[model samples]
Target: MAIKAKNLSFSYRKKKVLENLNFEIKDGEFIAILGPNGAGKTTLLKCILGLLKVEGEILVFGKDPSTCKKILEMISYVPQKSTLSTDLPITVIDVLRMNSKELNEEIIEDFELCDKMKTLFRELSGGFQQRVLIARALMKNPKMILLDEPFNGVDVLSQEKITKILEKVNATVLAVVHNINPIIHAVDRVMLLNRELIAFGKPNDVFTKENLFKAYKAEIPVVICEEGIIHPLYGDQHG
Candidate 1:
C-alpha cells in the first residue's frame, strides 16, 4: 500500500492550496502530516479521496485515486470529530451504522457506545463523537486510515486510548496531527507541509531545530534532555 505524490498542485477557484508537493509512504508505515492551519493538509487528503480536482500524480497502490472507486475503499477517512458537517437528529450510533451493517448494537456497545449511542451526535461532546467515528472507521477493516486531527478536542485519557488502539491495529495510519508530543514515539515518520514539503523522516531526524524554525516561522530554542532527545522550548508562549 504505497502512497506517493509527484509534483502535485491544487487550488480552490484559483487560490492555491498545495503546490509541487512530493512524498511517499511505504507499506505499513505510520506517517503523520504535520502543519499549521490552512496548510493544505486536509485538502491533500481530499485530493487523494477524489473530492477535489488537482494537478499532478497521486498513486495509491500504483493507481490513480481520482478515477478509481476501488482505491476509495482501500482508504477510510475520519473527519474532525467535532465538525458539524452532518445533518442533525442523527445519533452517534446511527453514524456508525451508516458505515457498516455488520456493526450491530452489540458491536457498538462493545466499543463503549452503550450509553452514548442514544444521544444525538450534535449534542454529544466532541470526545464522544470522535470515539464513535473511530469505531465506525474500524468497521471498514481498511488498509490505510486517514485521520484529520484525530486528537483535536479529545481528552487526554481518551487520546491515549485511541492512540494505543491505532498503534495496535492492523491498519497503516496517515494522520494530520497538531500536538505531536504525545504520539511522536508512536509515529514512524513525519511530513511537515506548508504548501510544500519542508521535511519528512523519523520524528527525531526530521523535527530539527532549523526545520521547525523554518516551518513554524518562530524562534523556538532546542534543549538536549536525558537520552539525548531534543525538546523545543516554547519561550514566552509557555512561561
Candidate 2:
C-alpha cells in the first residue's frame, strides 16, 4: 500500500475537521479527493504530508510519515495555485532549478513550458503558472505526489495537459480538488469527503447522486458519459 490511515481524525481549536478517515491507497493508484470548502480536504492532505498531528495513524509505504524523516523524501507536495505568489520576478527555469541541480528537460517539454523558460514566473498566465508548479513538483521524481487544487486557476487546455501528465506518472497520486471533471477520466478512484469519508471507490461507484448529496450537502447532479465515466455537474463548492 502507498498509504494507510487508521481511525484518522483531526481538530483545530477544539473543532473537528476530519473524523475517522480510514482508507488505503494502493501503489501507483491515482486518487482524487472531492469535497466542499472547509470540509477538511486540504487538511487531510496536510495530515498525509505529516504537517499536522492528528489523533490517529497514517503510514506511507509502511513507514509512519509523522515519525520517519526518510518517508518525506519519497513524497512531493504541490500547494494550491492561489496560495502561491505570482508577483515574484523569478524565471521558470530558475524556479525549477531550485529543487534540483539538473533540470528534467522532458518535464519542461511535456508541460509545454520550454518557451517560457526565460519568462518571469509572475508574467505567465494562470494556466502556465500552475503548470510550472506541477512541473517543479516532478523534479524530485518522488514515489508519491500530493497536490492541492492543481486545476484551481488553470485553463481548459492546461487542465487537460495536467491531467495527461498526471496519468502518465509511475507513482501514487493524491489530489484535493473541488472540481472533479478535469480528472474524472484519469483517476482510478475517488474519495468523497464532508469532514469525513463519505465514500471511497471507483468513480462510477462513489459518485452516485446520493453520495454527491452527502458530500456537498446539496443536490449536485451526476451524469454517466458514453464512455461510462461518472461526471459530476457542479462548480466549486464553497460550503
Tens-place lDDT digits, model 2, residues 1-239: 99999999999999999998899999999999988888898999888888899898988899877888788778888898767777878999998986677899999999989899999999999899889888988998889999999987789999999999999998999999888889999999999999999999999999888988888878887778999897888647533
TM-score, model 2 to reference: 0.97
Residue 191 deviation, candidate 1, in Å? Answer: 0.5
lDDT of 1 by residue, 1-239 (tens): 47888999998888889999888888888888877677788998898787777799888888888888788777888987556575578987678876676765544654578888678887866677787888888777788888998878888876776777678667778888876765766788888877778899977776687787777777667766675655555522421
Candidate 2, which segments miss by more than 4 Å at Cα?
237-239
TM-score of 1: 0.88
> How far does residue 148 in candidate 1 sit from its true spot (Å)?
0.8
How much lDDT does each candidate structure score?
Answer: 0.77, 0.89
Total residue pair clashes for candidate 2: 0
